[model samples]
Target: MDTRYITSAAKPEQLPDFDLPELAFIGRSNTGKSSLLNALLGRRSLARHGRTPGQTQMINFFSVNDKVVLADLPGYGYNVARRDVAKHWQPMVDTYVRRPNITAFLCLHDCRRNFQELDERLMFMLGRQLPIILVLTKTDKATRNEIRKQKEKLKKRMDELGIDYQVIIETSATKNQGIAELKALVLDPHLQVEDENS
Candidate 1:
């Protein structure tokens, strides 16, 4: 569980040279991307959590055990982003996603809220390009019934939209729920992509 900070890139050209398999964590603001990263890497604060929405504005990379690279992308869909970040967010993300080393995308979604249009649009765009696993974050805050209903609704909506996802994982960084399973998926060399029918 040795994780070290690498670099933060505000532009595509600034990205470091890394041959390691990379997993990008992306989601809407306040979806707990940093917290889940810390939990998954077994480090209390390796990835800094933003106290305010839209505070993370760059692509931050980290080396986990000298094995894989964890890329922390800034959260989207926040109205309060700094003007510069807002201007550059789209292109930076666009380039990063197309990088040859990206192994998978871990799309975090807050379990307490219903899906938004941005969620659908982002998933639709990414679905055809790379394997995406929808991570239902902050599950500890919701009741079991609430989580179940939300999952059902999300699946139904994805089906209707024809948005394909590799898997859906319920995670609670605070409670450490499903962290091990998620870690296994990320580190597994032969990460399997399950069809929508399965």
Candidate 2:
């Protein structure tokens, strides 16, 4: 699929005025969001993976085949101080998520570790508001048994939290695992922006 960078929005007004359905990618710092995005799009360095945690401070937008908009949200819960997250990041993220044009959210999680309090908080926030897909990233770092156990554990946590997510996708960006499934999900023709009432 064709993809191109649109623009980065540090404030609400700076966001690109696109009418296309949007998918927002979000997760904690170092969750391999960039790597996964690149893998999904079949392009290397399309999302620019950073070595330092929380390197992405702005919301980066990319157009996918000119049919869908992919919003690369700034990764939270990184090396940032508590005050910085509260004073800046939280409000910015809150504003973006409230927009009606967002079709769904791709929430990434690392397979090597259990979901933390921050991840749960995000799940609770987006639970009933919009469709969510809990993407387990870096699956190649763990064994097949370990991946299965992690998926099962995550399913239990989601069940306990009552998060009605669409699915849990396991992906290894380097090894090209589950990339096709995610890409198809993003490019599904049936997905459309939801209105406030519907």
C-alpha lDDT of all candidate models, in order: 0.84, 0.82
Candidate 2 lDDT tens digits, 1-198: 898988898876776777898889999888899989998887788788777788667899888889999999998887356576556777778888887888888899999899888889898788778758888899889998888887888889988998878777788999998787778767973443232111
What is the TM-score of each predicted model, taking all chains together? 0.91, 0.91
Which regions in candidate 2 have their CA more than 4 angstroms from the true location? 79-82, 189-198
lDDT of 1: 0.84
Give me the runs in candidate 1 sitting further than 4 Å from their true place: 79-84, 193-198
Task: Give me the displacement of residue 112 in model 1, in angstroms.
Answer: 1.2
Which ten-residue region of model 2 has the weakest summed lDDT? 189-198
Clashes of each: 0, 0
lDDT for position 68 in model 2:
90
lDDT of 2 at 91: 70
